[model samples]
Target: MVRKEKLDSMFNAFSIVSGGNYVYVCDMKQDLSRWSKSAVDYFGLPSEYMENAQSIWNEHLHPTDREYFNESINAIFAGSDNNHTLEYRARRLDGEYVVCVCQGVVIHDDDGKPEYFCGSIKNHDSVNYIDDVTNLRSLYGFLDDLKSAFWKKQELDILMIGVEEFSRTNDIFGYTFGNRALRKLGSLLLSEFRCEGQVYRMDGTKFAVIAQKSSIQRLSEIYADLQETCAKEFYVGSDRLTLSLCAGALHLERFSVSPDTVYSCLRFALHESKGNHHGELFEFQEVVIDESRNSLTRLNEIRNSIVDECVGFELYYQPVVDAKTEEMCGAEALIRWRNNDYGLVPPFLFVPILEQDSLFPELGKWILREAMICGNRIRAKYPNFVMNVNLSYAQLERTDFVDVVLDLLKATHFPAKNLCLELTERCRLLDVKLLQNIFVRLREEGVRIALDDFGTGFSSLGVLRKLPIDCVKIDRDYVLNIQSNKEDRNTVKFISQLAEAFNAELCVEGVETAEMRDMLRKFNVTSFQGFYYSRPVPIEEFCVKYSC
Candidate 1:
């Protein structure tokens, strides 16, 4: 009795000295009796709570945390552990909730039997690491903990989880419901992967986990588990939401990986996974990363070359021949790159990358101006010469696209009728109606529109039906095998018929053989272009050969 009173007095003095923070002493072996003046007031507990503090604490804890609280407390009392430090949400007096960190030390009697556990309570509402919405650590907190482990030279695997097509979810159901889905997913991940690692809520629809010292095989298993979990549908309000997850992982070994580099590499891998490896985990490879970095550096050089009007940027023209006469009736303008160090960089390698960037429109403008100027210079000698320039989605979607073409024609005194803009299938159009309107205006201005790579995309028929296109350029795949493959010949015949029905010309690309040309002739292909007649050549060489 005397010993108990002395401990109580010490706790009371300590609580007062600690600026009224909640402090408690519990006789774990004896009915779990406890005392704390601050906790009594903060939790709205009566004096009776002291008789059974374990029960009272358990009652106020968040339901999800109840088992953990019991396990940790029981472990200490059973002498399996000497101390316990845990954070959990606890309900307060006015029905509000706050996260509290409780740390306790187990005291032993003369015979080393467990006697009591004493602890202080710290309210962590202001500086809590836990995200309020997801109940996971915030990105900042996760990075901090990750850096700590990284500095200690521990082998680690970091996985970034992204909710696929998440933007469509927000667009369809509104952000409020989107947030609910995220919260549910966060809870699901936390509950499922607690043993494997700590999960963190990354910015918008991206979550991450730091699996400490996990092997590649274990990470692969975890990734498979996550895929299965996300495959199940979740209910939000009355709507059922289904999500597909893409994960990217980077293995970090001690001195080899820096925090910044790890994040950069992991994010890059995640983007690749989302775009190309759907439902799979992409592990970072040094060679792939090095290639990407080198490509980016080379692209930067290309961008600088374009901006500075460097000689590295030039257009090469490939002859488009009349299939029967083999006459060079027109040509398609193709962009090429040449650097002092890399010599002539392959257009197949760089053009597609540039076409997807913002600078593509600017590059398109340059191509249009140069091609028009060259076409005007040659029109007197060859009145039937046509200038075909390719257009990317970035260029065609710009509001000033038609105006830019018109301005270039006026500046170069080039006939709009001779200028053809080829729209490639790779372009993604958001506003088909807007494009149709632009096409109508351009057609009125005497500019022809050709649908390039016609048979490749899902929207090819839709484009023909809706847009004012003048020509259909059948993709090369059908033409390459038309001589041997009956299906290829039938497809070409069908496309030729379809084009004629629309009052459009059908030009077959990739006619590399005399047999291919003869085969296309049967389908009434209006024009043929490929290595058979000529490959893309410099503007100077093209003028010297085909000017007259």
Candidate 2:
């Protein structure tokens, strides 16, 4: 303890720079701590300088967070980690609980043993909500603060950074590790923009920065530095990894709309950053606001159309042909929407928005009923033919879903054997047990189940094995490049073999040419569906074109 004066001098520095935050220094060996007045008063501590400050602080912790806080403190004292960062709820003097972020580091002596702990605490209220996972401001907080700043007319620049391949990381390392890595990244971002702005942890591997009085040019420069930092490998515990980040930025002053509108534009920019720009920064342009969104007015149109008996909605059928005889064996029902204003709007434009929508179940029921009605017409000619209709998670989640399907089949006078319910790629989100039960119930009635967009999404083989599948429809991504992509061809062959092993027939989608058909036919696929067979047409047109 010969350098006692040096320790005192360092502690004195915190007094000068508390910056309206709670600053504290703990003498680990002595079990004493000195807190700034704000911390003492807010936390309702008995004294500014006191023994057992940790226990005193612990007493004020929210009941739900007390155990976690105690465990972390014990680990810190045991010298398990070099950094001390925690987020927890603490009771305030006003009898209110506030989410507080505590950040500090363990100061080691010459012997490399823990000697002191120093930190600051920032209380985040509703105006600056906090994320429990990362301890950063959450997207809700981002919107809250953005609205406040916007109303005040404070010029602001918003920057969004999305982590690439985060899902793959979670799949490999598990969600517990993914959450820790996100926390580490959040702290890194805090350090990067501490003096300049507020950083937020947005939903799903995306982070946002909102700096008052900042410009796009300045934010762009900041993003470059952040991108460079992320390129270098970082560690959460002993695990090391490098992250690729794509960025999107919006200058709020450039638009006169609400904060939500501004965020919508920024989201579009981030999508471009990931899909087209390969992690480069994509800025929101005024022209894109109109062209890309076509206005979210479509969301309104969808709701209204669903209410009006699905007025603008239509279903088109594309044939799935037999590999051996080239006869039309089945058809996939594809949904179409045609508004008077937009005229033939793409499914990609509205389907995604409505997939989780409350009205989707209603719309989904409409598609199934219509497909069954039309399938009845087709089955009159082709008795053994199958009519495939895509299923959505929204529809599947309903308790009445299985009942709806059975009722539609009976009401339409359609044979269950002639209809196949193809599970869309998103159905991967459902629990395996739930999916199995649904598939089994449908199969009990002789209705077929096909896993749509096979060889894509999480656990393709696993899904095929777990579910009672009658068919596996290969995704267009694989079939489109089967001619040149060796990996694609190998994947198709592997899936085909796997399907056969599971006693499931294989159908290849995106067969736009005869060569593709010949190539895929060599791989044990029984059916093909694509432009080569025929683009999806009206049900009447399908009957006339593929008539027996």
Candidate 3:
């Protein structure tokens, strides 16, 4: 009798604290002790209904939750552990089920056997388990949950964006500046998107926004505005910097049939944004989805190649001949892959894929090693011959790249002067100081540095003043129609004059026609390369033609 009195007091205290119902079930017997007035009101049970609480309560439980609720209660009563927590649906008098969370503790008898279970039940309608700001979930977790919730209600549109060469900016300006820039971008996005959606910082250099269900046209308009906003120059500590943003957007209703499928679709859109420049926005289209699927399939095959160390990759050498003497000066090493089943895949198709993965470093090392061996083989015949190898942004930024090159030269017993490292202008813009250091060290050892595709990127006159370079290869676009297009001719002439001012040899690429060649010659261009001389060919073929 005393125990029952104490239990009733405990129930009353709980009811007062929670402002809700409380129940104490003793050993699964049909009778329950101490029901609260709030419980009666919440369950919509009359005063008379309390006499037979078990039957009344059983009828109020949602059909879907009835079995689980009963099972959990039984388990709590049978176990020695005093705690039980569960979420289930409870039907109201109107036959509507409301979600509820129940927490309870089991009371033990003198012998340590379960005697009764006491618990409090609360309505969970106001609780948002997925999006409580104080919970401090990770960025990825937040994005996943946000995507799922919006997709579930069919109320989401997503945009993914990345700042181009984000790594380079971080390297040159330090992460402090990079982070501040990103934060400023985040603030801008929040101000612009908060009224219509939620913005999430997806990763170090990527961001995503979720908009309520909207038309494709509306999304496109917003995306264009966002592109414009992102393209504007930012001033980081008076260092005026212009960074490009590439964006991809998708409507939740397009490919996502369920909330869980939204993330995958968003990822597909994000991947499509790679290699795009500022103001470039790619919308989610059926073709993109198909291509993404195909690319993923190919990615698996590429992964296997890395594991086996048997990348069926081949090297093709494009001769860079002296324009005046018509003598082959050096060859640019090009890579091509031919799978047994897929046949030949172009470098443009697979190189980007490799760049996106960890395999790029290994593949770059292989290319360097193979090119050195082949170049040395030819050098054996012509001691003064040189070879140029293209390096990607990833390979060049590696701290050990200089060491790798020096080691390769020593191993091959080839003169460092016989190898030229060709980098695009964009690569130079990455970290002018670091690249200068690398180039300076290489130049000190007699290795030449050539700026490849000079006019295509952020052409900083400051770069020429800072770095020591031996040659500047004008991009093929400027040379393509120079003979016919006066603008192209003038651009080439202007670049040629600048090269002369810098005391750098100017090599014009893609000189296919005699007229283009003559134009380059007239502009005082010294070196040239294109199909007119020879397309990239096998080492054996190149050696047979160029060997002295």
Candidate 4:
């Protein structure tokens, strides 16, 4: 509970605020109400301080609105409410009925009953701070206060609350009902805080409470209560059910930071809560290590893109042509991320960093489903064309990976035989037994498997002997210099011979110039993928350049 002096300090702070509002305060113990000078002048009140204020206010309420006003106030004095908010018509000094929006919060005593109530009354014409649906302050209002607190360099703590599976709510009961549910949630949060000073309806089915007066520890306690309140049956309009809530919090002690940075970190924290914490509150920690901080921030952005429906990340297809026909036979789907700040980021730069991240499996699934669906479209042009996707170790280890793959194939209606999953040297780190099991299962479903960067891993020979792969993608290193270096030529010769022994097709990578392509022909390479044919491109461009 906020002490009387603190609430009084807050009321005084608002009384001098620039916004056009008529502030009011109520001492629940004394049953006395105090109106600001503006409110007294506008209402033509008998005095600034009124005895039996409720009865007096009730007398001035528009006749038709008397019932609602009485009930709302009755709820407050009865200790049934921690916050008060309503809209109604009230008769003014000129005897004109004016629509007014009243929003106030109850500051509690030790027993959690309202000790004081401080709120503002504003005319309907100036409601920019209020959210139409929730009646709590809008995101605009939240941002305005956030900026104000930030620029003032005050110590701040903020909680970003999101309803898990809220779209399902909309699906169950149309969006109109979902909005009502959201309003109920907003009111619940506002009540838990027992104040209208900070709680706000954020954009996109989320809520926020930014506080300079509350400590991080206090916010945590409040969040725990909010979570508990959601666990019980929460009535929304008429329907009642439990709401799943997740929150991300940040505590900043100093003012030497940017709100934009805080906003990103807080959002990242929320994403972490939803994705990894099972709806638990996650607090963004300031990293002391420079390298770790940069890495963390970079990965956060990448993960954010993935969560945003795989935005900024796209598949680029590189055509693989049969060496003899010198025509495209298949295409390898490579991913490229075009970050807003960094532009087109190369795959090597982002993929390696993400391969170890837990979210990589999700991104990997996106890549596979996207590649398969796109490849399915291309099969219309050429029935035998294959689409190859590289499997990250992160994806390979997911327990549901095989099931996910098979399900995607069925859903996308892409032929399993037209798809190939490639494994790089990193896949060597996974258990050989697991790799063998996955390879066999996929092969049984008519999906081909290939060892990418075949000669790059330390255990290249071991992987070839143990894993059942249909193709050996010779590392680009050997092919890059085959025309000039005898060792490169010999290495290509050795890999080709090994492919023959393993009965796997040999696809030499990095066959850049015509000279290199021709030089590689001596080694009995079955396919070639390099700039000489085409660099990786979008699905539409791939079809155009390698048209059937």
* TM-scores, each model vs. reference: 0.58, 0.53, 0.58, 0.50
How close to the true structure is residue 12 of candidate 1, measured as C-alpha lDDT?
68
Model 3 segments beyond 4 Å from truth? 1-159, 163-202, 208-246, 249-280, 283-296, 303-307
For model 4, where is the 10-residue window of minimal lDDT? 287-296
lDDT of each: 0.77, 0.81, 0.69, 0.79
Minimum summed lDDT over a 10-residue window in model 3 is located at: 129-138
Ranking by TM-score: 1, 3, 2, 4
Cα lDDT tens digits, model 1, 1-548, are: 87667567656665665554577877665654555655777778876237667777899988867877898888886789999877677898988777777888877888988777777878765665667778789866665566556435567778888898898888998888788889988987887667778899977788888888566567778778867856765666667777888888877663433354455556666766876677688886543224234444455567667667645888889988887788888889998888876678767665655554556688888889989887876687878888999887778779898899899989989999999999886564346888788889999999999989988853377779888888889888878888789999899988989999899998889989888888789886889999888889987898888754
| Best lDDT among the predictions, by candidate number | 2
Candidate 2: residue pairs that collide = none
Error of 2 at 172 (Å): 22
Pick by lDDT: 1 or 2, better one: 2
Error of 3 at 408 (Å): 2.7
Structure candidate 1, residue pairs in collision: none
lDDT of 2 by residue, 223-274 (tens): 7888887778678888787889998887765323455556655766786787
Residue-level lDDT tens digits of model 3 in 1-116: 66666666766665566654455434333345556555667668765224445556767886756766677655665574468666666776666666676788776678876665
State, as a TM-score between 0 and 1, how close model 2 is to the true structure: 0.53
Best by TM-score: 1
Clashes of 2: 0
